[model samples]
Target: MYLLGLGLVLSLLKYLEVGPVAAWSWWWVLSPFAITALWWAWADATGYTKRKAMEKMDQRKQDRINKHKEALGIQPRKPR
Candidate 1:
């Protein structure tokens, strides 16, 4: 909500030419978006994204299956 207000203020400033904000300088005003994109890319590279979360869940499931097999005197299948 604060971002929306800031964007609206920046847009108004740019449209009215009431400040030092030049039309071309509006690109500078979009730095927040670029920063957010960079953060998302870094998160993905660091395994902090949804795929890593799902992989962790799958690993827990496999562990449970192996434990169950051991309790039943059955050997768990090896991964291909």
Candidate 2:
């Protein structure tokens, strides 16, 4: 909704032949959408959006510790 209103205002300014205001306003309008889309794409590629990916990493680390404890015949400590 904000984007739509900004685009409308920019268009109106362009139609009115307003000099630098139109260009500056349009730049402000476009930069955020462009930056956010890029960030979302990067995050998607890196698996940052998935809880399962984080859980899997934690489980792998826990398994390594558990294996070391079992080899030493030591009981695992409970989480505080």
Candidate 3:
């Protein structure tokens, strides 16, 4: 995400010929896009993205269950 943002900022700076970025070549200005793509590809290939999503979902589900139990005045379950 940072890479993506940097790419956008650099591209704009290069386009407007502003700052030191103005002297950089187009490839250098656009390299962050490639970097971001590679990062996402690696994350997906390793199941990191999917694992994170699933962990978040499980956490939400546990929170909801705990809230219901609290409302019913039941004891919290012991962790394994």
Candidate 4:
């Protein structure tokens, strides 16, 4: 996640004592890690990630079915 990357960059900068970040408190620098953790937890607990993955998988399955039907020159079934 962007937050984790930001935390990593900030941590490196703080460790190396580079720029104005050198004066920043470790708490401030590490806050993005906590934010990322919380975001991941919230997303997982809400099934958001699972829903997205399932949607993608369903799309792939539909595509495969359609491709097979096209190859066989089969007509789609009419609805009752």
Cα lDDT of model 3 overall?
Answer: 0.97
Q: Rate the local accuracy (lDDT) of all candidates.
A: 0.77, 0.72, 0.97, 0.93
Instruction: Give the worst 10-residue stretch by lDDT in candidate 1.
Output: 1-10
Which portions of model 2 miss their true places by more than 4 Å? 1-23, 52-80
lDDT measured at residue 67 in model 4 versus the true structure, 0 to 100: 79
Report the number of clashing residue pairs per model.
0, 0, 0, 0
Per-residue lDDT tens digits for candidate 2, residues 11-50, read 6676675877556656664565566677668778888778
lDDT of 4 at 68: 90
TM-score of model 2 (CA atoms): 0.37
Worst 10 residues of 2 by lDDT: 1-10
Error of 4 at 33 (Å): 0.4
- Candidate 1 lDDT over 1-80, as tens digits, reads 35555666776777888767655487766665566677778888887898888999999999999999999999999999
- On residues 1-80, what C-alpha lDDT tens digit does candidate 3 reach at each position? 99999999999999999999999999999999999999999999999999999999998999999999999999779768
lDDT of 2 at 62: 92
Candidate 4 weakest ten by summed lDDT: 71-80
> Which stretches of model 1 miss by more than 4 angstroms?
1-37, 41-48
Sort the predicted structures by lDDT, highest score first.
3, 4, 1, 2
Supply candidate 2's per-residue lDDT for 63: 89
Ranking by TM-score: 3, 4, 1, 2
TM of each candidate vs. truth: 0.45, 0.37, 0.90, 0.79
